[model samples]
Target: MRLSDYTRLLALAAIWGASFLFMRITVPEFGAINSAFLRVFFGFVGLAVILLALRCPIRFNGKFRACFTLGMINSGVPFVMYCIAAQWLPAGYSAVLNATTPLMGALIGFTFFAEKLTLSKWAAVILGAVGIAIITTFGEAHSMQELVFGGLACLVATSCYAVSGFLTRQWINNQGGLDPKIVAFGSQIGATTLLLPLFIFTSTTDTSIHWAQGEVWASIIALGVICTACAYIVFFRLISDIGPLRSMTVTFLIPPFAILWGYVVLDEAISQGFIFGSLIVAVAVWLIVRPAKQAEEVKALQS
Candidate 1:
């Protein structure tokens, strides 16, 4: 990777790592519906500006439903689930748990899409589960029940992300190299639309929760513009420059940075279990994303 790419990696990791912290701090005031709604709404606006500035073609031509479906699974559902998880779990906890996205995808792919899994992948999935167990069972968290439930919520969110991978491959990829920026913009719009009713209901009935706080709204804007929108731009740019395999390596950096942010900002204690579990999770992700024999052969020839 070039120095500039490395810079992008760091920025991406930092922004994503800080996302959990933002959600943890703001979700109480914003609520699940409100937080999820604003994130996508602002993300759509921010992405629109970038697309317009760059003069990127934003085509819809028969892909609206596909884009909306991707948004529902990829962004909308997962955001709400993570918000709910944040209500109970620490920011660091959810960030670490988010690493399970690839693992969950591997399993879901095997089961639903009939994707062939190597022995290494099968073993990696089992090991990933063990890592999750270590974090929930041994890592510092709330009550055992809350820890379990919150962890499950994170798993559900990651699982949705996993499913979206297949959906994107089927719907978006089959459409002749669709621009990811367009897909991303469509997704934000879809998520915003999906959350409209919930946000409205939450705002109306949840009168007891205060909404006048400046810091809370700031966190919400940061979540949308910086974390969701900007992160996606950086991620797609990395993929264009370094290929998806290299870009996926960002998965390894997020948890530690999240743990650091949690410790620094939230004064959340970092324990040995977190370190051990995070290491295991990173190892498992490496195994999951590592090139298979066929891919390595193809890549060798291409290179």
Candidate 2:
């Protein structure tokens, strides 16, 4: 990768990693559903502006429904889940758990999509589970129940992400593929639509929402515009320039940034157990996602 590509990759990871911190900041004031709704709503608006600026065709070629439904699963549900976790888990904990998406993807693909799972993948799945258990057991939380629930919420979010990946391939990529930017824009629309009624209900019923707080609104704007909208543009560009495999290295980079931001900004404690669990999860993710040809080359060298 060129220096520009590397720079973009780092920027994307930083943006995404900070999303957890943003949620942690906003969810207390906005509530989980409200925070999620505003995120996709503003994300939709941000992407629309980008589309207009670039004069990109808004055509979905009759795939708007698919794109929209995928958005609900990909963005809407997962965003809510993470927001819920933000109430209990530290931002760094949530980010480290988010790294399990690839492990969940491997398992989901094997079970539901008929994708092959090799021996290494099986080990990865086991190790990932172990890492999660360690984090939950040893990491700080308000209570045992809250810790378990928060951890489960993170897993649910990652599972949604895993499912959406396969669904995207089937619905969009296989069907002559829409522009990635359009797909992203459509998905945010779907997410916003899905959360609209819930947002309304919460807005009316929850009188405690801190609507006038500048910091809360600022976090929401950054989460939606920079983290969701701009990150997508950079990610798609990285895929185009360096291909998906290399671009995916951003996943490995995100947790460190998340941890750094949490410690530096939120003053969240970094326990030894958190560090050890994160390392294990990182190894497991590498096992699951390392390219087959690269693995084969390493094996040959060892032999």
Candidate 3:
């Protein structure tokens, strides 16, 4: 990989890592649906402005169907689930569970998408599962109930991400490669539309809605512009340059930043179990990320 590609990967990691912090800040005040809705809405506006500034004309055909599917699986459903899960799970724990996205993506690709899985990939899945088990079992000594539920939510969210990634790769290849900005815009717009009604109903209670807090606005703005808009751009660019599996390395780094934000900003307790579990998860991801023949074949097809 080129230095520039690595730089983009790092930037993607930072943006996604910070998403946890922003969600933590805003979700409790705004409610999950409203928080997710505003985030996608702002992100759509930001990307739309960028596209207009660049004078880039998007070729939007009947791809609205595919785009909506991607948004539902990628952003809409997963974002809400993750935020809901975070309400019960620690931010750090939620993030660590999210690190399983790549593994989930790989497995889904191998099964449904016909991207063959080698022994190495299977081994990675095993290791990743073990890591998840350790984190769930040891991370909470008193009650595993909430943690288990959170972990399951995270897994479902990760699976959603995996499906999204495969679909995106297909989209890009079919279009002879597209501008990342356009893809980002389409997904954001789709998510905003899909989530609108839910936001109105779920966040109706006055006590649940805190639209006045400056922190809430700050979190919204940061998540919209930085995490959603810019992060998606960086992510697509990274995948285009380095391939999807390699681009997924960002997941391993996101947890540390999430943990840091939780500790420094929220003053959340830093438990040894959190540290140990995080390490195990990271190692498991590394095992899965090692180059696989099937992934290599998929990359070749893309090229």
Q: Residues 70-103, candidate 3, lDDT per residue (tens digit)?
A: 7777788888888877667667788888899888
Please name the candidate that would achieve the greatest TM-score relative to the true structure.
2
> Compared to the true structure, candidate 3 yields what TM-score?
0.91
The order of the candidates by TM-score, greatest first, is 2, 3, 1
Model 3 C-alpha RMSD vs. true structure (Å) is 2.9
Which clashing pairs does model 3 show? none
Q: What overall lDDT, based on C-alpha atoms, would model 2 receive against the true structure?
A: 0.86
How well is each residue in 1-303 modelled by candidate 2, as lDDT tens digits? 689987998898899999999999999899999999999998999999999999998999999999899789989999999999999999899998988988888889899988778899899999999999999888878787887899999999988877877777778767877788988898899999999999999999999776999999999999999898888767655655665435556766788888889889899987788888888999999998786888775875686
Worst 10 residues of 2 by lDDT: 239-248
Cα lDDT of model 1 by residue, 197-266, tens digit:
9999988998787889999989999999988887876765565566544565675678778878888988
- Where is model 1 poorest over a 10-residue stretch in terms of lDDT? 239-248
Candidate with the greatest lDDT versus the true structure: 2
> lDDT-based ranking, best first?
2, 1, 3
